[model samples]
Target chain A: MREVAALAGVSVKTVSRVVNQEAGVSSAVRERVSSAVSRLDYRPNLAASNLRRAGARTGLIGALVQDLSNSFSAGVLRALEDTARAHRTGVLATSLDEGVERERELVHDLVTRRVDGLVIMPASTRHDYLVSELRTGTPAVFVDRPPRGVDADSVVVDNASGARSGTEHLLARGHRRIAGLFHLTQIVTVQHRIDGFRSAHEAFGLVPDPRLVVTDISSAEEATRVVDRLLALDDPPTAIFAARNLLATGAVRSLAQHGLRRSVALVGFDDFPLADLLDPPLTVVRQDVARIGRTVGELIFQRIDGDTSPPRHVVIEPTLVVRGSGEIRPTA
Target chain B: MREVAALAGVSVKTVSRVVNQEAGVSSAVRERVSSAVSRLDYRPNLAASNLRRAGARTGLIGALVQDLSNSFSAGVLRALEDTARAHRTGVLATSLDEGVERERELVHDLVTRRVDGLVIMPASTRHDYLVSELRTGTPAVFVDRPPRGVDADSVVVDNASGARSGTEHLLARGHRRIAGLFHLTQIVTVQHRIDGFRSAHEAFGLVPDPRLVVTDISSAEEATRVVDRLLALDDPPTAIFAARNLLATGAVRSLAQHGLRRSVALVGFDDFPLADLLDPPLTVVRQDVARIGRTVGELIFQRIDGDTSPPRHVVIEPTLVVRGSGEIRPTA
Candidate 1:
């Protein structure tokens, strides 16, 4: 690298800039560096070992999703890994487990191991923790959720719009008494989805009963209990909108136990495995996970290849799948 | 390392073993090596460099499974990763899509990168290709299947016995005409399951109709088609045994479409997510994935820590879960 720098009549910093494909380098200067690099056959190691310095790549990508075991996250991971595999890069997979500290720790671990870049589904409400790594020129793309307190590339679904479509689907079916089951987590996605649900009711010139909106539904068991309580109310809802996958499953179980699976209408927010094979099947807001994952890979690789443009936040559209359950009549 | 070896009055090889905590070293020698290591404050770069000698540890573990998106494989990976995380180690995950060349290529890549250990769910019919890595002192543990052509640590469920149990469950219900649907791929586990299916019929002093046994059944769609064909036969099986999870899913869909879900008895080899949510529910032989994963982790880590004992093959027991589907009496 020093020889190349001297041969090109440039400083080591200039050589690094050219080698890393950093933006803002002059074309003429780049040509000179390219000539020197070709003449000397210099391999720049982006990751800091002397022998590895010959290549500008580390051949490793870090994937920090919330949970790799979950179907949604797992599908996205499969896409990312397949894409990376075609390019001959290995992925370091981690489960964030909804712990901010754990996410930060794993990220730090991957960074210290000198992975070329990262794909993250951040657990923290704020991403100020990532500023240092980004400044150090590490490439990253956030998936599932947008980053807060820091600028970065992101690929996410239009949660609010998707939720609004689902809610309106029920409203159009003549279900005036609709109940909502939602997660109480601080995740920004929940808020966006709730907003869409309210907006759907507002558009129809109706008010959603505050008491019908149940929060703090975490696990499938909890979702089942929440639905059970809703049904036990004096004026039970004619339809229910489950805001998450597990919640929908729990609702299914509860409905089955109460012999309401065929009577009460239900629409879920996310598509899950075998959702189409259920007795009445399940209607859901389906996001193209593979497309989202691919887009995320593209952005992260672009940054790795030295595109220092403004950060991109790509919002993918979600479509409503109207299977039997969601299309059920109010049956008043 | 040289200084530590000299101070401990041992060879550099002994120093390496002591530092890596390999077994078979005398306690006195281990104590001396520890004291010498403390005195020198040695930090062994398990992963070698141009500066590092060849055959050093990379402190990374490679996990190659069939499909990480599938629930069974995903569950195993989650458990393995959780175990690795506690030890401050990272995991490199790969999905082997039934391509032998792909599996070999990935193993080569990981070996070249000098990962310290590996956990593989082989896609190849034989694993003789892994001989070189095992010979080079790299720790490996095979999951879901035992390694062939070369010896290595492994943790697998008893597929044959599990299948036998599921088959007998249906036979006990007086279903003489039982159909079999299994993966076409020559996965050893699947072969064992087929053997068990044949064994069950033999035990009952009856011969299985060759026409009723379908092979090369790959996906859920294929399973459904196979079941539909069976039902259309002149003497359709009164009970069906699908030997895989996806196969079970397809069978359920086919039965529902033909309106035979309640009438025709069904028992599957593997349990899947939401099996209980099906109308009559699904009965299956369930493998303890968490235990398999944990066992694989233990064996691999043991090898990494210098326990060069004979390759230990651990066989986990599978249990038969009786839901409604398996207990149904044959109609007509």
Candidate 2:
């Protein structure tokens, strides 16, 4: 500011008034100061200025997801970023990697940076730790899961219903023995999906074989191993309902390797890019990730804009996309 | 500081000394001040302190990529974020969306935020605008594309050679009429891939059909339309070399729709996650995106850590991964 004032041959206060667009600065002096500012390439410290001004925005938000590399999380982040960009706000994205401690740490870090708002796909079961931050007026919107032990806006898919519909689709296809592959049951979403899978069997008045239900499948590779084990069983499942995208990928690989792509019915939860291009075109219970992300973006921005409304929970209904795979009939 | 002092029954200067970790602060006073600070959840604004201290890091960096939703960009971002996390730095990632103006605006915004460093997959043809920022001591490393009109460290895959290898692999499989699908010709990487396509045909003592060489292809849908038009040609190419991943996806869709998945050979430049799972399994010139990301991360952090050497350019060699599509014989 001093350098700009000196270059413009004006007082530092005059330069400040020009920079801040304050009234009472003459056109000639304002032009001179502006030219000097441009020439000097001076960027006023927004972080510092934002500190002094109440209700000043930082023009940046933080998005914490389970994993940025995963298709679902990446898609959600992309949607949030697009929405944020429309408001001229940038997003700082980080992956929690399903670490509860990491989520807390990252939330703390983003809070320390004073992000205008937050969009979190939380790994932690409870978000009580965020109460103080919420109380202090840093609004946050949770995605993919509801916040436990705290009041916050959230957008989540109807995971249990989506899973039930997918399982029911396979059962209606006359597949008597259906296998279920899932992520860790500790995750609320995963547990909800498991509940849906069980409810579908109950609706059909058929008991799901406990031996065919596999959990704790974290990666596609792990899912593949689980599928291989199930396939080798004496009473192998005639169909598979993968409750996660990665698990679905594993099931696809296993079915392909076993030359059973045409015989075994399969349905996956969570649609991914190229799902339609896969052999038999993967059948999926598709959650509108883009919509979920947009909802989260909207909720967080509203809070940032000082909307003092009570927290709202939004549950998006997932749709069944019947591609070739789920339509496959049992050969037995 | 005053609030902490009041809570801890200490002088403001004593709290400041403890927070700054300056010498001459008694451990008892420091412990009392720290407890009070924790009790109040008083986060010392690092942004404000960073402005006052020379060489103080904001513990944040900026990453500007083409798009976050795309597999390549997302993979790179995930790797970079992992590396930055190890260094206790957060990355604020933004997508350029192939807009030069957006790139400039985002760069200026990141600069204004006083990020410690930057990693850019540049959209602009000329980056003389970044010269000022670089001169101002904000380190940046370019990725996927090299920086132009300015000196900066860059990590890029061998585009020309990668394209050439993919084309040659098709030619070796008795494909005389090969279609070349590429991105925008203005992009340096796309242009280099086109050059490689032409050179490979030249090496084989053949001239590529002008009608078969398509450019300006952006999305999978566009690529599919282009492929449909090419297939409608009376003299259609037997093989396709898709220079971009989306173009490959389009080509795959077209072939599948036309019931030519078994007969039409196709090779893609960049490999995607589901490439191997597609019908006929996509053959590709695979650039190690993870490695490229890691290389970019290392270079940028090194620059941020005061490595003032001349700008270094790193080129990674791409490898050919033959699944099934590229090995198909041209049955004219």
Model 1 chain A: lowest-lDDT 10 consecutive positions = A43-52
Candidate 1: segments with Cα more than 4 A from true spot: A1-55, B1-57
Clashing residue pairs found in predicted model 1: A43-A54, A44-A55, A45-A53, B46-B57, B47-B57, B184-B216
Chain A accuracy as TM-score for every candidate: 0.84, 0.97
Can you give the lDDT of residue A93 in candidate 2? 92
lDDT of 1 by residue, A147-244 (tens): 99889999999999999999999999999999998886588888888998999999999889999998778889999998899999999999999998
lDDT (C-alpha) at residue A328 in model 2: 89
Error of 2 at B220 (Å): 0.9
DockQ of each candidate, alpha-carbon based: 0.25, 0.72
Q: State how far residue A73 of model 2 sits from its true place (Å).
A: 0.9
- Deviating ranges (above 4 Å) for candidate 2: B20-24
Q: Candidate 2 residues B1-332, lDDT tens each? A: 78999999999889878887999988899999999988888777766777778878888899999989899999999999999998999899988889999899888888988898999999998999999877668999999998899999999999999999999999988999999999988899999999999999989999899999999988899999999999999989899999999999989999999999999999999998889988799999999989998988999899999999999999999999999999999986
Clashing pairs in 2: none
Give a tens-digit lDDT track for model 2, residues A33-114.
9999989988777777787787778788999998888999988998899889988898989999899999898888788777
Q: Which candidate number has the best TM-score?
A: 2
Best by lDDT: 2
